[model samples]
Each structure stands twice: as C-alpha cells, then as structure tokens.
Target: MAIRITGTGSYIPSNIEKNEDFNQHEFLNEDGSTINHHNEVIIEKFKAITGIGERRYVENNLNTSDIAFYAAQNAIENAKINQEDLDYIIVGHNYGDVKHNTEQSDTVPSIASRVKHLLGIKNPKCVAYDILFGCPGWIEGVIQANAFIKSGIAKKCLVIGAETLSRVVDKHDRDSMIYSDGAGAVIVEESTEEGGIIAHESATYALDEAHFIYFGKTNHPEITDQRRYIKMYGRKIYEFALNNVPAAMKSCLDKSGYDISDLKKILIHQANEKMDEAIVQRFYKLYKMKMPEDIMPMTINKLGNSSVATVPTLYDLILKGELEGHIINKSDVIMFASVGAGMNINAIIYKY
Candidate 1:
C-alpha cells in the first residue's frame, strides 16, 4: 500500500548561463554594477556562502511545458513502464507556460496531453491536471496522487514538478541570482513494496510575520492583492523555518514509527545553503546523527531555486548517478522537507 517511485528523470536546459554571462547582458543595477553578475570574486562568494557553482538556463522563447515534456518522456523511458499505464498526470508548478486563457493553454495538462499523444496513450481516462503551491508543490502533488491511487481512481500517476523561474525572476535584482530554470518527474505507482512514501505531514502558519513574498500583479481584492513574484524577508523566513521544519519532520517521522537516525538521507527544499546548514546544525546538536550531505549543491547555486522543481530535480540527480556514491541507497529512508510562500512548511518520509 505504498506509493513507490518506479523511475525518476530530469531535463536541464542545454544552455547554461553562468553568473558571469549575465554580466554581458543588460542585467545591471542602478549603480552600474552587474545585477546578475558573477565574476571570480562573486562566484567564489556565491559558492562559499550558498554552495552553488552553476545553474541551468533555457532560451528566452521556451516555457515550462516544454521542459516538462522532455522530463516526462525521460521518466517514462527510464521507468520502462508503457505510457499506456499512466492513468493520471499531475503537475506541480508555480508558473505555467501561459496563464489565464479561455482554456488550458500553455499549461501542464496541454503538455501532458501532447506527450500522451506522442507516446500513443489513447485512453480517455488517462487525464492530466496541475497543482499550484510555492516550493512545497511537489510534495503536495505526490500526496494528492497517493490519495487518487488509494481510492482506485488512478492506476499510475506521473507526478512532475517543473519551473521556468527565469521567466518570472527579476533579473535586475541580485536576490534572484539564486534561481534558475528546469524540470523533473517521477513515476509513482501503487505497489506492495515495503518502502516508499511512509508518511506525509504539512503545516501552514498564518502569514502573520511574512506574507509579502507572495507575488501577483493584479490589484483585484480577491486575486491580485498578493505579490506575484517571489520575494521574502530572508531573515524572518529563515528563523521561522528553523523552528518549524524540524518539528514537522519529527511529526512525520513519528507517524512512520521512525526517528531521524533511521533516515539514510534527507532532501530539503534547496532554497539557501546557509539556511540548510543552519537547520542541519540544529539537528546534529539535538540528535547527534550526521546531517545528509545533500544539503548543498541542489540549489542556491546550480539551477538556482527552481521553485517546485528543486526536490524532483534533486531526486533525479540522485537517480542519474550524480550523487550515486553519496547520500542515498536502496531502501534507504529519505526525508523531504519544504518551506515556501504563504509561509507554509511541509515534511514527508520516504524510502528507496
């Protein structure tokens, strides 16, 4: 009765624009300094502070769906499961290719549908949909997929988390340098396997302290009041996460009848290297167990913050042999924790 990740895959843009590349572009600040610049001094500082060396980038014309298409195809092939077996395709994305049409244009559904046609999955029951959450979107997608499977509504689900963060990123802002663009996918199927998604728990604190990060441009009191681009009071969010994420992790671990020591690896939302280290240090002090080494490299550097795409992309990196000898193993207990806009935090335990 577990949802097993049968296969994992990712699609990074072939074009990698290093921080230094941005210096040549029109991305500059008011004081005539490079806004998205990354020279030797800046790159070294970024690596030292965030533990990120580089990030992926797509051309200006491409959109989120295009990346998701490639990622889904790779996942299908990697899993060796016939595309016909996919009864559902659920996507977690902060930005779709296009928004607000009379139809589902430039969205995940259209992307999945196109892939289905290409792969020859003709069944009408094989439907696709999208889910929106900040960084924790992928976790929410998996949990929802699990519910559909448990209720016998779906036989197999393609759960994907992808983003074209550069599309919304304010390139003129230095804070946006920590973000990049990419996509990742997972093939989740109901199985009798002993290890998979053991427990999932989430918490959404009232946006009393930090709600300014939510971004949208419209002024409609109902829909546009929230800011549409990604913004955060870094220090405030960091303190909140340091306090909340560990508690949520403890809650999920307890539900699964496991402890931090039982976990073989931990994959947190790769938002900031500094924040990740801060949380890991706290955990080490409390439990004396070593923190998962994956805290760095997943974000704040390469691929920047791909928003919802971070976890699944990191998951794919593990599967693609990038982290093969480190941090993960067969049947190893893995933990995923996320903190995003809406000031929400969630944690889940899984096994591979």
Candidate 2:
C-alpha cells in the first residue's frame, strides 16, 4: 500500500505588505538607533531579482498554530474525514507560536499540540509533533507520514506547514522583504492505489552554513516584547540553494527509478524566483534536457518564501488548479524540494 495525499488546503493572511510600501524607517539598531539605507533601490532590486511583489502577514493577535488550525480544518473538510479520524498531526515550522504583538516565540506546548487542541480533536490515540527542518519541513513531515503508513504504524496523518515570518522579520532589513505569513496542509493516508509517494531524498551541509539563517537580537532594546528576529547571509543561501537543490531533486527522481521526462511538475520552495529557475534548469541539464518553464510552477512572486509553508501551499494551489500556468492531473508525477536554515535540503517524487 502507498501513502497518498487525500486532501490539501492553504490559508494566506489578508494583510498585504508591498515592497514599495516599506521605508527605511522600519529598520533600527539594537540600541534604538536608525540604520540608514535606501529603501527604493532595495525594493526595486528585490523585486527584480526575487520576482516578489508582496507578501502576506497575520495580525498582531494571531500565532503560527492558529493559521495551522485553519489550514488543517480545510484539509480535513476537503478529505471528507472527521478530525478525530486523524492518527497524527505533524507540523513543520521554524518557530512555534509567536507571542501576541511580537516576533518572539513560545514553544511550551509545541505548535502541533496547540493546533490539535484548537481544532477540538478529542482522540487520545492521535499523536502530534513538530518537525524542524527549515524550509524542507512540510515535505519532511509528509515523508515521515509515508513511513508510518507503510510500516502499518498509522492509518491517517495531517501534515501542516505554517509560518508567521513577519513576526521574526526585521522591518529594516532588506532581506526581510522575502519573509511572509501563511499556512498549508495535507491529509496523508493509506491507499492500495498504484501511485502515491514513490521515492524521496534528503541531505545536510551544516558546515559553517547553519548560521546562514539564524536567530539574533532585535533592534529594539527597551521594548517589552522579545527582541529576536531572523537574520541571514542572503548571497550565501542563494548560492548554496542553486548549487545543491538541483542535485537533490535529481537524486530523488533517479532513486525513484524515474526520468525527467516522466515528471509532470516540479513544485519548489519559493525562496528566490531566479534561484528556483536556475535550480530547475540545472536539474534538467543533469538529464541532458532543457527545462520547460511551465514545468516548474512558481508562487514566490506573490507569496514570498514562507519557509515550511512554501511546498505544501504551492502544492495545494497546483493540486486545486488555482494557477494559470500550473495544473496537475491524477497519476501525474511531481517532484518537491526545498533548502533553508541548517543547510538542510530534501526532495520527494510523488504520483499525484
């Protein structure tokens, strides 16, 4: 039996923050000093290079688990299954529940547990946990789910990827423009069908690269909220991803006993538009073929990079035929891959 995705759903916040709307005033020094920077030039370059126009952010009162709950609700409904039927709730996230009004986090109960509670799931037999694999997290969750089902340890699992990156993003940092907020989910269950998750691959290159994206002190020192946000070396991450992601994808397909021509789509984490394009190009090059632009659908332009949420959210969009250039039919082969903090990268080939 294969582990199959029975349903998929996503929830993006309504608040829209455009690159052009951000000013230099948002950035600051830890001592409350200003960091002088050209906002217009940065936004233009960001839009030109990343192909991102804007990103969504949740209100001050919301948290990661809250959005995860909404996404899980939709996936459960789409799967036509009751919440209690879920054998596990797996959440892929970089940060846990962000404190109200701040980017600081609270991980006491774990986001998955909180989501299960918010969904009113009463089954004591249902297990819940968190997977911290940077941007590859959601896919990692599903991969683990596949393992459980194939081993007869589980019947159904709800995998979720949700992030409130705005909470951890420093408004003054240009790199922060790429972070957004959103949630995506899927219902992975046992199936006797011919296609599901065919094969997957993962790798770690943490040597000096783990600090590429990390937590650090915030600019505001006297503020009551925790002064912590995401910090990174953008160029290094871009280089690492473009160089390694393609190899990971290729290995996954080859290990799955498939070829580039057999794939229908390549859904990737929306970190950088140009980088993703290059990665796909390199992937096909390994097979001595040219990549068809339409073969790899993109959401980086509108959603930015929501870390763990990127894969599942974009997958849901394609699965539901919500994008113009991207669509998937039953029995089509699709590949998924992502790389981020920890220098962790992974890929999975599935029959949709």
State the displacement of the C-alpha of residue 100, model 1, in Å, after optimal TM-score superposition. 17
RMSD of 2: 2.3
Clashes of 1: 11
Best by lDDT: 2
What tens-digit string does per-residue lDDT give for candidate 1 at 1-352? Answer: 8788888888888777676765533434424454354445555665677666677777666677778878888888888998877888877887677432211225634555655655567778888777776788888888888778889888788988888776665544455567778888889899887888889998777748547365533222233233354445666888887887777777788898887667776777888888877776676556666565654335446667787888888888876778645557688888888888766777778988
Cα lDDT of model 2 by residue, 1-352, tens digit: 8779999999988988887778544656446675555667667877999999988888777789999999999899999988898899999998888866654478879999999999998999899999998988998899999988888889999999999888887765567888999999999999888889999998888877889988876666555655777988878988888788888898899999877788998898898998888889998998899997688888888888899998889988877878877789888999888888898999999998
Q: Weakest 10 consecutive residues, lDDT, candidate 1?
A: 218-227
Among all windows of 10 consecutive residues in model 2, the one with the lowest summed lDDT is: 23-32
Total clashing residue pairs per candidate? 11, 1
What are the lDDT figures for the candidates, one per model? 0.72, 0.87
lDDT of 1: 0.72
Q: How much is the lDDT of residue 124 in candidate 1?
A: 83
TM-score for candidate 2, please give it: 0.94
